[model samples]
Target chain A: MVSGALLFQSLILGLLLGGLYALLAAGLTLYFGIMRVVMLAHAAFIILSAYLAWWFSSVTGLDPMISLVGSVPLFYGIGYLLHRYLLSRLRPTTMTMMSVLLTFGIALAIEGLLGLVWTGTQRRINLPYGPTSISFLGAQIPVVQIISFGLAALSLGVLYLIMKRTQFGRSLRATIQHGQAAQLVGIDTTKVAGMGFGLGLATAAIGGAALSLQATIYPSLHWHWIGPLMAIIVVGGLGSIPGAAIAALALGTIRVLLEIPMGPTWAQTIFYVALFLTLMLRPQGFFGGRLAQRF
Target chain B: MPNDSEVRTAVAPPGSTAVARLRSLGSGRTGPLVGIVVVIAVLATWPLLAANPYMLSAGVIVLNFAVFATAWNLMGGLTGYVSLGHIAFFGLGSYGTGLAVIHLGINSFVAVLLAAIVVGLISLLVGWAALRVRGASFVIVTIAIVLVLLLVFQSWRSVTGGSSGLVVPRPFPDMLRPEHHRVFFYIFLGLLALVLVSYLVVDRSRLGQALKAIREDEDKAQSLGIPTALLKLAAFGISCFLTAIAGGVYALWFGDLDPIFQFDVVLSSQIALMALLGGVRYLFGPLVGAIIVGSALEYFLLNFGETQFHLVATGLLLVAVVLFAPDGVLALGAALIRRLGPSATSIREMSAADVRAQQDERAAARGAGAGGSVTEEPSERASDD
Candidate 1:
């Protein structure tokens, strides 16, 4: 029912879309690895950052991409302080469950605050070149998506360096593997935890800015974004960053590709169905490997 | 009952046992039941006292939510499977009733019953599937279920009426009259009564104890020969059954069934929040939560027009409850009473406080402590701080 070029174009767009998804899901997976908390408010946090990015860019007459210059550091501190003062207190046995409820409450509060301030009006970062398209292998690609994809790759690359090379990253990996065991070796797991959460939120900030470029965002728009991100992480395996990256891109492509024939609603439904099915049949995820037990 | 008595016996002085027993008995299982009965009596006759249409209308909403929360408590409180997607069954139940009413031309009341069965069977399947994964996975799976159902309901426009909404025919033909309000109020109130009695029985029975055991330690419960999985599924099914009935009744009364409006995450969270606010384990916790949430929601909708101040207010309250009073209001109330007033001087007061304080202190200790049971998982990075 469709042309060959359209299918090729969709595949390209899907990978780009998935690039954004990885950036978004990375924060959530990082939190799970460190704290075993699902961070239900992750989507709300992203939307909140998107709003802040929008406001900052509009006020300073800078591109929304530049808003990340402020948003990432700001949310890092917010995420750190939040983990210390509030989330850290929940008992570990129940932390997994309580965090979902508590973060859900936090999500509601964020949505409410955003609704009050933004009035549910959808806003997007309107770059002058946003509407322009380029012929990439004979398929039209929007400039906004391309920029967002490049920025996403840069951010993900930085994330890789931090996770693999830094002292903080080593401690975070240790804590993820074993909290008390890491502590026994003279590591301050609590400090590592706070910083890990901060790092996660920082990624969310970057992801949010990129998201606002290609998609219209509002207070409740988090609801739509959350399901897809959850599907990505769950499909990739809870704590496996590489797995999440692959799953995000694969699922993102499939969703966009499916949209061509099935329409938007069914395409989205298919993603959520995958989330449900994967979670039900294989709680560890398709490729999560030994990293499955972290969450 | 034996556990309660044995614990009280240990805490109180041997000579003061009789007095402690009397005081504690008045406030234990029977005490709450009596209080609930009197509250029901007052509510049952409330329309006669003041036939204000507005109050009756609002009361119906409270009762509807009370049923929803209370039903949710059956699953969450008993099994510790706090579902974030009970909204799926709720929406399904509403659609079931609406469809049954529309197509079969059956009595709306009968349709409600039929919807309950449909939802019950569906939940059995859902619970069977979702119960495979516990904890975070269960929560996410539930969310997925609700979201997927929402997509189906939204896209399958031919049957569901889609975004425009399925217009349900109200069982009562009156328009905004006091009589119309009273009918729903009584119907829900009646359902609440039946639900509470069944819940009270379950709460006091071996089954309830087994469910609580599952909540506290599923591995231990299973080791002890309790069919933890089956019980969880049953509780889930029962919980969804009641929630669906409430949804059906809500549809029949309100005359609309929109996908977004019915299968809402907010409503699901609100109901879960209500159960949390009320004290999930306590028999009347959800009832208490429903009254607070329902009334507060109405107040917000009325005063702050065209906005979401209510959402903000409830969200803050939910956070506070999770942070400070994870046990719920009744537990909080008992603690306060033990701490501040009714001085520990009187023997009766001493016994009551002693009995309650013992339980409260344990709960408090658990609430205050960090992770318990040396569950040193393989990768647990051994950290002191």
Candidate 2:
């Protein structure tokens, strides 16, 4: 007999976890939507941002949110250059092979560099609201969890607005839909691709900022996130933002629920097993059709 | 009915038709078969020439990777699936052998066979589910499958020991080190030979042609009644079976099984690098690539010393190779070698008119490549038509 309060607590935790998942999945979906290149290195970039946040918080007492002010812009520049200068040159056949190798190389480089600088120790940021709690209904919810979910929703809302109302967003969508047609209409595809990449990386920065709250981060955290992140993207349907959010929530809920009965180890396998089954049944994906429209 | 292999063989070289080339390459052809037999004979006797333990150990490593890489090449290079989760098969094999020896008290030979079969069955299941998706989806699914397997190995502590890892004691504790190593080395070499012969047979056979057709155009192959699904599953099973056997050999050589060591991403990435750096389309691509990259990196680390720069150099080398030589170093080096000594090169240069005719022939092949009716283009989810 699970109490209403206990169920409420799980829901709150799932919501918070979903926010973090959405933040990671959004970037991945955006990259896939625009370029059709699965940025396998996206997880590494998130880990990199987390390490940077940890460094800033430790060194200057700057908050994780404040650290993103610098990291997001820096990552934006890096992503743009990486897409334009490095990745854009390859043809599809070569691109498919090179992206994996290149991303693995990038992941290794990030890990090697982080090792040189920070060593293998896991780092965490201490927030003032780290232990604070808020009363909701009959149960107490953590302040960090509330803030995490709120921030994730607020940022996603802004992203939705930008994609819906902005001219750049329209052009970005156009480029994704048909590059040749978009070019014929005088849209600068290269710029659109670069901006799309930048937007993806920026989301990673935001995610990194949010994720450093609950989890201890090391360079190897990249590996841990990659599996779940891919699952989220698949379930949400590749390139669909709303699909990603819904999928993240669904997955997070399943994971949290499974954790209670099956143990964490089995729960981890359950998510992947579910994802594998989902792909087998619906190869085009759950949200792929809606996503095709945005593209 | 002749398939593109025949066309590729026939038109690929002048003074030789596809049938003639196939025959020459030892698939019933006279000339290439004899030459290939001679090469095999020479290679088989090479161990006797290099009797040093150090050399023998190095040879063992080479043979081990050569077998693993060849296994990888089928799914990754030849079939164009590019699996990143191949170490799952390897890990399964290690665990199978280790479990058999410890729990079931099985003989080593029997254990190897069981491991291979287990891995093959697992691969068949994964392929049946995963091959439904195209392109990057297949890659992602394979990786996820491996990740799930890794989690199982880590979490199933009673059976797998979680992070602490499982150890399998050597079956023969009394054997001398060099003698034991030599026997294992010979075993691996024999495995390598069997794998190569199998690869050659498949590569020259009708199924090989069908697999390539599917890779080139799945829809077209499906329309032509090639059974793309079954072919992919078959390829996956075969590839995984060989990889698992190699892993079993690794377990026997090391006398232990560790999840972290056996099923690591590094193993997966290394196989991929080996397959690509050699030449995916070539039969010996992985071996060539592994020997070049592996020996070079080892030399650099050992002789010139080690630093973070070694990793940085490796990363840079990968970038450089992808950017400058998408076709692999073998192709690029052959071109350079030809330019340097065109007169003495094994490949004969065609006359200008012949070259023009060859270009025309290639354009026709390209037309066939592009002209074949299949929705090679990804379906636009929004487009109604």
Which tens-of-lDDT digit does each residue in B15-89 have in candidate 1? 777777687676575655565567677789867865578888888889999888988888888888889999898
- Where is model 2 more than 4 Å wrong at Cα? A1-3, A290-295, B1-59, B296-315, B343-385
Q: Against the unseen true structure, what C-alpha lDDT does each candidate score?
A: 0.85, 0.76
Query: What's the distance in Å from true for residue B264, model 2?
Result: 0.9
- TM-score per model for chain B alone? 0.81, 0.77
lDDT of predicted model 2: 0.76
Residue-level lDDT of model 2, residues A10-36, one tens digit each, is 777877788888878999988888777
DockQ of each: 0.43, 0.33
| Per-residue C-alpha lDDT of model 1 across residues A156-224, encoded as one tens digit per residue | 999899889999889889998999999999899999999999999998888888888888888988889
